[model samples]
Target: MNAVATSSADVDAIAQVVAAVERAQQAKDAEGFLALFHPDALWTTAHGKVLIGLDAIAEFTRAVLPKDDWDGRVTYEVVHTQFLRPDVAAVKVRQVYHGPDGGSEGAPLYVMTKQDNGAWLLHANQNTPVQTD
Candidate 1:
């Protein structure tokens, strides 16, 4: 998705995209989640496989997420929202997770965007491991 628009409506679109992503994750609806990405969107993780394009993202998710059976619950702390234009916005989100395997985790970044169709979608996402030194 090209993030080069400038308007209040664009900002709203981005927010909707963020909400959709969260909903998809909670529902374990990989299709719904992947549908939000562009045809050729790319994703990089802190570790494990790199997902490029919608198909790859779906495949990667199917391969890894099952190992955890995530509880489909997450809490988001939106640090800030930046509008590079209007359609292009990068929202810094911190997500807290409670894994089903009795393990707790958190994702520190979830970027949101507004696509060319004026619909918001998750263009890229990367969850960072918290450092506790």
Candidate 2:
């Protein structure tokens, strides 16, 4: 971790990126969601499928997101953020999907990087379903 202090501005920016993700997922807009990712991003789905790069992520998103069968909306909330560097952050998110049946939760960790233009983009992410006993 870089010794630099984490700023509220950076946290706010990261939160905005997360909010965009929620919006995209709720709207089933693959392109909108993909726009927030880095070219070499890695993503692991809640079900354990791993996507290696933007191309692979794009392919999967396009194929699966629109066809999702859940008749409800999903929400993503940023629960914590750790700054690894001035330009990189590891964010923990609480994800919930509410449908006619009930609600399912997920714990997603998103590693995001800030670009030269100061824009934060998702670099790597893993979504793990919350198992209830």
Candidate 3:
């Protein structure tokens, strides 16, 4: 996935990984979401809680995800991807929460690493709420 050698397939695969996150969120499937992360992945919540690893992330998400109700839908769009190396990338995402009452958004950064098996797994991620004036 290096910039020089990046192919459409690589970009598509990365987009799919990002889409999977949105799917898991919509379904409130904690396990499904966790499967996308590396064993030592770090995740920071939009509200600023920092989770150090898979275990901590799982614990937090299992409790919070199920309690979430968007009343409409949520979407995740891959806005950009910067390849740090052939096996690593920094992906920027635009996240939107849509509901009848209106919506909110977040800008998330997901740093993904290509696994030995060639799958892209989230290595580190941060969710920052998009504040509107």
Better of 1 and 3 by lDDT: 3
Candidate ranking under TM-score, highest first, comes to: 2, 3, 1
**What TM-score goes with each of the models?**
0.74, 0.95, 0.93
- Please estimate how well model 1 matches the true structure, expressed as its whole-model Cα lDDT: 0.66
Worst 10 residues of 2 by lDDT: 63-72
Kindly give the stretch of ten consecutive residues in candidate 3 with the minimal lDDT sum: 1-10
Q: Write the per-residue lDDT of candidate 2 for residues 1-133, one digit (tens) a residue.
A: 3376878989999999999999999999999999999999999999999999999999999998888586539999999999988999999999999987788999999999999998999999999999998
Model 1 clash pairs are: 3-88, 5-86
Residues 26-57, candidate 1: write the lDDT tens digits.
77777777777776667776574578788888
Which runs of model 2 end up more than 4 angstroms from their true locations? Answer: 1-3
Alpha-carbon RMSD, each predicted model: 4.1, 1.5, 2.0
Whole-model alpha-carbon lDDT for candidate 3: 0.90
Highest TM-score: which candidate? Answer: 2
* Candidate 3 segments whose C-alpha is farther than 4 A from its true place: 1-4
Q: Write the per-residue lDDT of candidate 3 for residues 31-122, one digit (tens) a residue.
A: 99999999999999998999999999999989988874544279999999988887888999999998776888999999999989889999
User: Candidate 3 versus the native: TM-score?
Assistant: 0.93
Each prediction's whole-model lDDT (CA): 0.66, 0.94, 0.90
